[model samples]
Target: MAAAARLAVAGHRVAVYERSRTHGGGVGRLAREGFAFDTGPGLLHLPAVHRDLFVKTGKRPLEQCVEMTQVDPAVRHVFADGTDVALPNASRAGVVAALDAAAGPGAGERWSDLVNRGREVWDATRRPLLEEPLREDGVERLRRDPYPGAARRGLFRRAAPRTLEAVAARELKDPRLVALLESHALAYGLDPRVAPASATVLPYMEQTFGSWYVRGGLRALAYALYERCLERRVEFFFGAEAVGVVEKDGRAAGLRLADGDTAGADLVVAGVSPGRLAALAPGATGPSAVPVPPGRVSVLLALSGARPEGTVHRTVVHGDRLAELDAVFGTGAPGTGSYRPTVTVLRPDDPTTRPDDAHEAVTLTATVAPHGRVDWADDGVAAEFAERMVRAAAAAVPGLPERVLWREVRTPAHTEAETGAEGGGVPAPVLAGAGGAYLRPANTTRMPGLYLVGGFSHPGGGLAHAGMSGALVAGLVVEGADFRGSQ
Candidate 1:
């Protein structure tokens, strides 16, 4: 939708061909039994990406299209040891105080310092890495660690932390703090043990800009973008899956759809997984396929009660991390293993989600190995995981077991059928460490006139990152290779 709107605004005749009947692929809405739930992303951060797109492409801003509400006390963390802390949104002082009160004396100070350093990292990478087209240099500049850690001097050596885990262990000095840091990475399908120290920027970005929610649900944001495209006269064809890019003289000349119809085009922007893109545009090479990480296991509940006043919108009920991390980040193959899981419970304060004030809608999400690893396609496996997740989420919603009217289980298999992500994987946002281990496919392809957008492209996944990818792709298409980025 971002690319279509931008191109249309640029006075280029634009038409979007989507395989699915709906616009938003993963960012979809589910309405069943009088309950409405956002089937994809539960939280939205870095909304400015879409805000800028709206400001540039149309007279109306994003807020005019979809109402957004800031989520205060952004997240409630329920630790394994039974300690709970609700961290306030965009409040450094509050977060520090909360950490000190929950973890120990000076724990908040350590977190404050980490955020300060994260600010530096964000400042350094925000433009070149995100707002701009990926440098042709393959971002070798980021290969060198940029995390600010305590430096040690020796007779002939200097040492500093390089990974998120190392930074947590060295600086935070609290198991809860370490778990907190690791959870940030884990939530995104990234392993803190391998994620760069700069990954700390995740928390800083959320806290600094603040987490937000569309008044209805995240699906509302997707609908807003789609509506913006329609306003810009971007034509869209549903169920017209492109079989391949029509090539003429080594450039993308048009698209060949599955129905034996051809749509000639000046350019082609593919918002698809790397594997699908390769199949659609043969001979184009992307970054070597990274094993698809685990996808989300969500349990949607319709409870016969009202949302408690002043309840935190989101909660993280930490599980046995020691037993879970290995299973989550280990091999992607199926196996029998004892698994402990971290569960996130979401209760949005919106009447639109439920039948009435007397009823409430709740969602529970957990990161587990992708479908291939545990056969999420199997009803038995999915049901068992859903039950486990619901039990854990009971910590977030008191008497949750008793309050349930009915429940719905959404597994990775559902994601696969909807979005064509291999193994129903949920892509993670691009990180700045591990020697480009997290870099995604560049917008420009060897196949001239063909560009990549969406989660599979440069700047990586997440709603905000995918929107940024569109901005980068649009800039490259409109302004040419010399285009640095959106100013």
Candidate 2:
């Protein structure tokens, strides 16, 4: 939608063909009996991406489209050892103080120093990895990790940590602190043990920009973008599934729809996954070495009681780190019975989410094996894992079992049915290390007039990165091949 709106404003006739009736692909909402819950991401990080989109494409800003506010005390962490700490939103001093109070002396300083190093990583790759189109030399340039190593004490020099896990153990030291650092990677389906140390930019981005929430839910933001696209005269055709890309004279000329109809276009921009793109346009080059990422399991809880005052919007209930990582990433047993998996509990204090002050809505999410790895469609399998997730969530929400009026469980099977991603895999953001294993395919493909957009392409996943992907595609389309990025 962002790309469509920008193209329309730039004097292009834009038409969006959507397989589903809705606009937002994954940013969906679940509402039952007057209670609502966000089925995708609970909070927005780095909202500036959307703000920039609104500013460039339309007259109204993002604030006018959706009521957005920073979530103070951004996230509360319930560590494995029962130690709890609430980190204030976007405040370095406040986070340092809170960590010191919760994890003993020097703990906060160590974390602060790590984030300071993360800032360096952020600066080094912000342009090449994000704002700009993926350059031809992108892979080679980003293969070298930019995270500076911790200082050596003696004369002998030590090599920098190559992975996030090594960085946490070497710098943070504390088990709770280690969990805190690794959780950021886990949230995006990245295993800390193998994820590049440059992944520290995840926490740095969240802590620096602060977490945000839109009024009603993130679905509102999607609706706003859809509306913005409509205002730009961008036409939408729902229920139109593109089965293949029509090639004419060695260039993409149109799309072959499922209903035996074709929509010819001067330029074609596909927002589907790499696998789907390959199916659409045969012989198209895909990412060289991107792994199939894990999927998310969400449990939506509708409670009978009102949201308690002073309750944090987001809470991370840390579980057994080894067990959680092994179950999700390692070649271990399928079930989560051996250890409690880490779960994130979300309780938004918005009246729109409930019938009235007498009711509350909560969402629980955890990263897990994708559909192929685990049979998410089996009722028994999904229910058992959901039960464990709820049990893990009990550590954060008081009287959670008793407060539930009803619950709904959604697994990767549901995601596969909703979106056509293979095995319901969720893509991770593009990172600058691990020999460019995490980089996504470039926006421009080998076929002329054919472009790629959305989470599966350049810049990769996350609300912010996906939005940036659209911008990059738009720039490439509007300015031709020489376009670099926004100034």
Q: Pick the candidate with the highest TM-score.
A: 2
Clashing residue pairs in candidate 1 are: none
Q: Candidate 2 — worst ten consecutive residues by lDDT sum?
A: 283-292
Tens-place lDDT digits, model 1, residues 56-114: 88999999999899998899999999999999999999999999999888999988888
lDDT of each: 0.86, 0.90
Best by lDDT: 2
- The true-versus-predicted C-alpha distance at residue 169 of model 1, in Å, is 1.1
lDDT of 1: 0.86
- lDDT assessment of candidate 2: 0.90
RMSD of 2: 1.2
**Backbone clashes (count) for model 2:** 0
